[model samples]
Structure formats: structure tokens, C-alpha cells
Target: MIVHDTPLNSYYASTSWIINITIRKDNWALTKTIQSLSFCTIPNDGFFEGIELIVTSSTTPSNGDKVVIHYYGRLAAKQGWRFDSTYDHKDQNGEPLPFEFVLGSGKVISGIESAVRSMKVGGIRRVVIPPSQGYQNTSQQPIPPNFFDRQRLFTTIFNPTRLANGEGSTLIFDIELVSLRRRRKL
Candidate 1:
């Protein structure tokens, strides 16, 4: 039984009609179930103009939380690359950043939220986001000017949650899940 239908639900329901899903894991965990239900099989060079995920998150995560995860493979066709350099703010003498931001409020890039919404509390997965879903035509720190045009940024955020306020950096996240609450229906 499907518990809650978040953005992922709508996305999969629409995309599934055009793709085939193959479940590789038989485990009956909630994460596995959701992934099995939403998994889509497309050729590596398929005409996917937007973001795609290997697995989708079952729990709804809020801002000001963090999640831990392991590294996985990543690739960007537009960039002609397969990986990005990892940086830990806290390791660089910068304070650990919070994962808090209003969903769909443009506080963070669309790619970050899209990736996070598809992740479970303890699940680790790789995400491929085109520049249009990411920084788009804008320039920011770490992301060089016009980088979006030359290449798409491929990041691996493990168990990503939201960040709290006063924390800088827009596109990337190193977070932990502190809580998951349903938003009241209007």
C-alpha cells in the first residue's frame, strides 16, 4: 500500500507510462518497495531531458536535518564527465552546515530538493541533474560562470536532509534527518 503521495508519486505516475521498471532487490523494506514501484528502465542514452534517480525516498524529510550515506557512481552526459570533487565544509575549518530550507521556495536549487525528496532517511543513491534543473543560467561560488552551459554538475549526496538558516552554500548538501512531519492540508 502506498503511504503518502508526494512529488515523487506524481512524477513516477506520469513517467511510468513511457518507461519500464525492473526491480533488482527482492527485499520487502519500505525503501525497496517504493524503489521497486517507481523504478524505470531506460537506455543509458535514452531521451531523458531532466533528472533521474536510482531510488526514491519513502519518508518525508523537513529542513534543519542531516543524513549519512555512502558514495555511488554518478555521470553527466552533457558534461562528458562522471564525477565531481568532494568537499567537506567542516573538514575545511568551516562549521558544519545545517540542511534547512523551504521546499520549492527557491532557497536551494531545484536539483538539490529533487534529489533529497527522492531519498529515504538512511538510503544512499546517486543523482544526475541537468543544468536546467540545477543552477541553470546563473553563476555561483564553486560553480564557475557558464559552467552550467559547458557541463552539468554531478553530485552524490548521501542520506541528504535539509539545512538550517544562516548556513551558506546553495547547490550541495551534507545533511542529517532530524525529523519528518506531514504538512497539513490546506
Candidate 2:
């Protein structure tokens, strides 16, 4: 665009200049989106694939309802342990127990509630819980030698299952939502 500031007079001189502008908002947004997605891709046969959701459920659970679940949790780090489980493994001496708790009741860890609330009956889901969500209170002093559960001895000798994770470690869980029911109102 050009503009003449001088009037149309023989004695008046007109000076016109050119100005160039570049608008890059769209390019900047696209670049940021691409950078973010780069961290979420999976390497499949030398090709990157987006994260996939596997769905196999019909009845979903909601907050304020009671839910029964079976879960197996393991630390994702190397030399990690199976910290918790409800799977019945005879050789492991584990008897699958149905864990029942009210949603949002705070009886269970934060991750469990978040996972359960999005789950359906008979559905299986794998979730990764960061340290912020589970066992954030690592500052609590370790249980004394006198304070121990019945299985502590067995775990000490044979397999260190149900291990206590270090503070800020990552935990991975395979949760199976068994059933859920609405709480009766008084």
C-alpha cells in the first residue's frame, strides 16, 4: 500500500515508501502443536503411530457409586516390583480378592478412583500414575521393625511382591472393573 502525503501541486514533492509485514500466528500454532504431538508418538516398525484407545466395555461407572475391581500394579522403572495385585496366582500364594470401595470416597488412591470412574463393567484398562497421585506422603516415617504385616516375612525371603515404591517413582496398573452399583439414598 502506498499513500501520498503531499498535495497535488507542481512545487510540492511526493515521497512514497513501501512497507512489508508478515503475520505468522497460524504457523506458530501449527509448529507448537506438532512439537507437542511428537512426544506422544509410538515407534512402530520404524513408523510413528498416534496413541490408540482400546475399548471393550458397555456399562460405565460414575462417582458416588460403589465399585468392585481387581487390579495389578507394578513399577515401571527397571528393577521394579509388583507392588500390588488382586490376581489369583497359586504359586505366588495370592488369592484374588474383589476390592470394593465407594467412588470418590478417598479410601483408595487417587489414581484408582480416576481409573474406575472411566471404566465399564468387565472392562480392563492400563493406567500410569505419577508420584503426585499415589503415595505422595512419603514423608511419613517408615514403619518400625515391630510394625509389619503377616506376609512381610514371606516377601522378605521369597519374592518381594507388594513392594513399597520409592518416592516420586512411576506406577503402572492393570485395572479390571468388575461391577458397580448406585448407593441407596436415605
Candidate 3:
């Protein structure tokens, strides 16, 4: 029997991982032990409490820097409930144009600002944000193109604060930090 212990640093933790196991005829005795060990379990409701962040790539950008990103937003409670996207804005070459904003700026939502602040250029992250860090009021940007879709979103799950029932709304964002540049000093 052999045990391979891999020490993972904070940097390595941001990336994905894959575990593979190989067994020979002689290892059949250990197969029962391995099979007994549970590998992964996904929840039926697909709801994870609080913020969940998965980093697909990693890079570091400083505050006050101008950064560009591509993102898709959805309602966390509803599967396939994509509310808004930047994909509509594309260049003449047919490439999706990224949204640009300064880090730490109030232009975007608090959740987005918080997520992008820790990201590096070319880093992609999926973040689930609770109402506390999400939209407390109507945001002018990223509205759905279809009137009915927009109405459904705003009426149902967009702004928790605006809802009379006081139910909370959680949002999920898949964000990719495309590039960043240092803030120019005067």
C-alpha cells in the first residue's frame, strides 16, 4: 500500500483538480474499500447557502486598475434562468465585447466588484452571491432585451428590496477577467 500526499498551496487551490485511480488484479482486495468511499454528491435542489466561488483560472489585479470582463448572470434558485449577458455587444469581427470598469468602482454590483477584485487577468470565476451583496435596488445596466423577460425578472427575482414579501434573491455570475491595466497617475 502506498499513500501519495500532495501539498496544495493557496495558489494551487484556485485551479481545478482531477483524481484518477488504477487497479490491477492483485488490488482487487482493496477495491471494496475504495468503492465504499464516497467521491461526490450533488444536492437535489441545487442550492448552496451563502457565497460559492469556483475559479477556473487565476491571475491578480490591483484595485483602481481598469479591467475588462465577460459575464453571464442568472437566478440561483431557478435552473437555466439566465437573466442578463454582455454577449449582445459584439465587435464587427463578431467577437463578444467585454464590459470594462475600474476595480473598486461603484459602477457594477457589490458582488461583482468583490469577485473581480481578487481575480487576475485571464482568470475565470463562477460566483454565487446572496442578496446582501447583490442588487438592493434596480440597476440600470444588463436588462433583458425582451420586455416580457425583463418584466418577469423584475417582478419575480431581480430586486429583493423592492419585493413586498421581503423574500431574498440570490444571483450566480460566471465571470471572466479578460484584461487589466494599471491606473494612470496624474
Reference-based lDDT, each prediction: 0.35, 0.47, 0.57
Q: Please say which candidate is ahead in TM-score: 1 or 3.
A: 3
TM-score of each: 0.35, 0.52, 0.61
Q: How do the residues 70-173 of candidate 2 rate in per-residue lDDT, one tens digit apiece?
A: 76665644244565555432234444456778887766766667666766686655555554454434232111122242134223322324344332445556
Candidates sorted by lDDT, best first = 3, 2, 1
Candidate 3, residues 57-172, lDDT tens digits: the string is: 55667778988887877875556488776665567876666788887777676777777776666555556665566665666344666687677767766544646566666676
Q: Candidate 1 regions off by >4 Å?
A: 1-58, 62-87, 91-98, 137-186
Which portions of model 3 show Cα errors greater than 4 Å?
1-59, 140-148, 158-164
- Candidate 3 global lDDT: 0.57
RMSD of each: 13.7, 22.9, 13.4
Candidate 3 displacement at residue 94 in angstroms: 1.9
lDDT of 2 at 79: 41
- Model 2 lDDT on a 0 to 1 scale: 0.47
- Clashing residue pairs in all predictions, respectively, total 17, 0, 2
lDDT by residue for model 1 (34-137), tens: 33343322122221122233433557554444333322223322233323322222334553323444444555545555555545654443333333344433
Q: After best superposition, candidate 3 residue 33: deviation in angstroms?
A: 26
Write down the RMSD of candidate 1 (Cα, Å). 13.7
